[model samples]
Target: MSRRLTLLVSAAALALIGTPAIAATPGAVSADFAQTSVWGGGYQGQYTVTNQSNHAISSWKVEFDLPAGTTVSSSWDATETVSGNHYTFTNKSYNGAVAAGATAAFGFVAGGSALPANCLLNGATCAGVVDTTPPSAPSNLKAGTVTTTGVALSWTGSTDNIGVTGYDVYRGTTKALTITGTSATVTGLAPSTPYTFTVKAHDLAGNQSAASNAITVTTAAGSGSGSTWPLKVAPYVDMGSWPTPVLTDTANASGLQNFTLAFVTGNGCKASWFNAYDPTTGWDRTDIDALRAQGGDVTISFGGEAGTELSGSCTDQTQIQQQYQAIITAYATSRLDFDIEGAAVVDHTSVDRRNAVLAKLQAANPGLQISYTLPVMPDGLTSDGTYIVQSAASHGVNVSLVNVMAMDYGQHDGIDMGVKAQQAAQATHDQLKVIYPSKTDAQLWGMVGVTPMLGVNDDSSTFSLANASSLATYANGKHLGELAFWEVTRDRNACNGSLTNCTNVTQQPYDFSKRFEAFTG
Candidate 1:
């Protein structure tokens, strides 16, 4: 939680305990602003708009002008439009009405040096509006027997000063689904997976209630006739401003259903604020928050091609474990991916320690999915890469996926990048079967993942659009676990000599994403 939110929440609780209400004249409307989190170049801001009139308002809008150079990257609870320094936000269908004395809240993440000023609600100044109340949480959450592919969930309805608009279902910190009804069924679950579920209710005014009691449910075991394949696609999203783009913009423009948030590493050796999120634009939770609001999921990835791994600094077992736990708590995503490269992969001690910490997290977080992104060759995984998977199994770590970077095969020598990627996936699949001897070939393939750098890779090898199509077709036919590309930031038609950032080739915007999206079923 951010410090600003803590203070606001505390104030709200006190107001409920008979503290005199902040006085506002009847028939006047007002707005309250709060800064949730801030970092180097940007901040996450929230606004609460209240109606003090005796009658209800059919709809409302808030407008403001951001400081020069600042831009709104993502938003929630309202529809937003930006023109130059001006931004206008209107209520969505379910949150358009504001009852008498009721309030609604919206949040946004922006990039720049400062926040907007002179905010207005419905063309009126927001200087006098004051609301410090939170809605009540829903209760009586129940989970039915989990099926092989889905789970049935329901909960008691919650009341609000205005009206309950919708409910958000979280598998952990990541929202699994959102709906307006009291009951919903979540599908696309892995067989035999144990999951923990929680729910929260929000009103038309945008104030969310406390979380409901968590319920545990395990999906039915596989029928055992054959291996079940779940083919999904996610593109890598950089934490830095590489390729000169923000996460929300890249995500909104992508065709893939999920994203892998890249490279959360130590600022330097033994830095304070371990796992402290500082993206290229700044530290703004609203990026991920807004993505979840749009029904997109994310997997927090640690380590990248560069940077000092936290394990390198926090050598102590306790410190290392705490660092890992901090990330899990912050994102609350059911999935975690480790993109091991350079010394991060070769350090045997760090590898063992990482696997140990991950194993403990898996045991503690039911239904947590763990994936390892390691370097691979045309034939198969290198010795170190093999140790990564082997160490996980040896340490009792239940790894759900072993995704190989199929780009930059070291010695390309003019082989088709797509064909090499397929060969690498098949080789990794074969090795996985040897590691888990009991798993069927289909099951082993289902546990394997492949990521290709779209267009030109670091080694100057090109993965053409036709190559992307070929890989997608192969992935679907073989029922592979997942297919992902190097990044969404570079999924465009033109390149700017950025071998590692942009594809640097002639292609359409999101062409690779569109090609790989075909793998989704």
Candidate 2:
């Protein structure tokens, strides 16, 4: 027989195979049902029917006798028929005939004053249903007594029907953490701040039940250590991409524990040049304020070469200076990052000019931070013969750190270019330290773009989650300041290299549209 015909015959034979069956009353079908109470609202029910007859069943009908105080709401796959408070779901027709040894399924939804008890499926009566309910009431949900800059929250495990898949943690109204198989630890909470926490259980079907009891805990005071910086893992929320505030906030809700940093467009001048900020319609001060109130920080980044307007008459120094002041004063931000690329023709004058601009800004705001980004150059040479590292330092301008665009550099060349790029960055850092003896390795920040599509012809150059993790480990081992990516939207999360992987340690997503409220410990 043909290959396709042989496969069909095998499937038919397998379908007909069965074990010995017990005798049952004629015209009667044995039905079993599963019911689960969902957390937000509503309940889910699953049903299985055994065809005890010697013949095949073409169709089936399942009638659920809901107890007092419940009513049928809606259902899927089957048509729900209601009479008073009871619900009956009729299977239109089985896609394939169910053999005597096989089983089928049908279910419906019911709404009522309270959860029903002693629900019956088909003609069979069951007791209070199966207690497939997951563990409940996450007790002792408080921060550890020995408070520190971080908050330690613990809770009891939840029960499940077959088994509990995991626990999702929420800080106040925002989901802060997702822990598989129960326990999870939430770090990077601000010192001396109070936070509310709640936990929920997830089942194999991805069904999450009601939240456990709520508890509040305050973080300990800060020790003025650099490690104390709130290190959280949050999702990326982009206002420019999401013109609507509601959509932006919803996107943020997916990964609440992560920091939210906005992507603002600046012409290498002031911070708010082509401001996407909308007070009444989209992300505005209110959004930022709300984020801040929730123990999150909002940072605005400038100079994205992708589509930002960086070339124009605004390149003039007077306009640049005015725009800079406007951005800093209006936004009240302590730090600003300059994405220096493409515009090298206009901005690359001398380290003296760069330092003068930066110093003037710093003098105006004593607490301001200035960071410069450089294209990943394997040779670490500017077109003007200026050493990027030596020039910045000699001009009395604290470069903060360099964000080497490694992906771009490698794509232009190959994977071998990455190693060369890393070597160049290390060499520059070493040279800087030799000149500035007090400077530590913590001042260097490595930039890597996490994308699935390999830029260079070499497949090994593709940035995967594993690649990010390995790179992060390397940076940390070298005492590098931190790892930053080109854009969070380009991250691959689905393992297929299309979605952003928020869980990746090397490059966590940061949403910049939200507010920076103080942590309430």
Candidate 3:
């Protein structure tokens, strides 16, 4: 309806909501609390609230007191409110109803020392069957394939009371992932460096086993072009084709591991599942699932230059979050992206709602990764885009990447696209300093991403294949979070003169993708 193949327009990120629990009236509940990992003046911990009575508990609440200096920074599965040294956690809608003798587990990241005490549930002291015994330490902890910036891990499971809900994989003292399975792939590691890792098992009642046998592994040395973040190229196949993307048309088939499935959107203002590129059918999972089966993954992109953004599709915040959640649940990817532009960028009300929903989503799903893609000038983000970034940080949204669209800057001719892109990235890194003063320059760079339109951009400026190579080198040298292009389908030399579809220049196919793919971060 707007431009780019009648696609519509824009999208954004998320926030959270929760009602406070009534005065503590501990009814029929048992609660367990434990601290799992600690580092950088912060600690990771969990609280398990179980329905202990003979009947099911439809709703529950847990209140506890932290050590004098500690405070909850971010939490999941429950709406947490801190008052002085006391913290109150109420079950979210999804986890409120527990079956008789069932347990719902939730975890949090807290600042200061973690020493939580005086736990109560439903206004009553939560003293469950005291299981003071911790589970057996995880055994056979081993490293799988070691890459330039990551490693795959696996270990024998630990037995526990009420079953082992999850395992904590620690890189040094940092809790990398609270994985539900025995195996996990930990990313964002230094290349060509040796690191020690350990694992611990935890159960429904706040009990954690001793650490697993530590294993040290050296990451394979990376070449000049390398990154610790997940490397992804975009617009894999088109929606019209549905699943069988023409892979050979662009990048080489070997060593490609990730993609951002492009442009899933709500139908106009409906927020129903529809591919904006096609708009006639639901998501085509055939190709996506196949990629996953081959150990590759896709981060679904909602909102391109077109479509009704889910944030504006519904008036009610709950309904809007539900709409976004549907697609997330269906796809079940750990990562997601929102390409915010056009009306979505300036829609203040929707932006606020979206931010709240994202915070809630992050709290509900720890380890969920998010990225925001926005239009930018050669310098930096516009005020609106900066607001989006600030809002995400303020709402406690864990945005792993902030990708800037580094093309089409007012049709300025005779500009070096690579330099413009690099400047834009640097500007973004600078802007992030205000939001994350605690992060070093290098850390901020790692959180920044750049997405350039390959070949002839909409502004009719050419981004040569050489530009692509240089930009990839810059991104790798800076260790940026990601490097992407507008469309993988257009990574070819066949130009119909329409920058909307294919490259503008004549050259070898998949050249741009190959160059960008060299950046593994």
Candidate 1 has an lDDT of 0.72
Superposition error at 466 for model 2 (Å)? 1.0
In the order shown, the candidates' Cα RMSDs to the true structure are: 11.4, 20.5, 19.1
lDDT of all predictions:
0.72, 0.46, 0.69
Model 2 worst lDDT window (10 residues): 512-521
lDDT of each residue in 1-521, candidate 3, tens digit only: 11112111222210111111222223335776655555678856666776654545555678888787788888877888878888899987578768767788777878886567777766656664444567889998887555565666778889875456568889999887765567666655667789899999875444789999999989877543332245444434344334446433222453455677666666644453344333221245444444543455567777667665777666676776666665555454556788889988988787777788888886665446678999898889999999998988888787878999998897575678888999999999999998889877776887888988878888778788889899888887888888877766676435666665678787666667778877855
Encode model 2's per-residue lDDT on 1-521: one tens digit a residue.
Answer: 22111122243443343111222333334455545333234444456666554444444555655666666565666767777656666664333235666776654454553444434433334211222345554555544332343444555676654445456788888986664433344544566778888888764334567888887777766443222223222223344554333323543543433333545554344344236442112225444434433444444555555434232324465555556665554434445555545654245453345456666676665435455555545555344323544556666655544445555444434345335545655655654555566644453322221111222222234444444444444554554433454334433222224222232223333221121111111
TM-score of model number 1: 0.62
TM-score of each: 0.62, 0.43, 0.56
Top-lDDT candidate index = 1
Q: What value of lDDT does candidate 3 attain over all alpha carbons?
A: 0.69
* Most TM-score-accurate candidate: 1
**lDDT ranking from best to worst?**
1, 3, 2
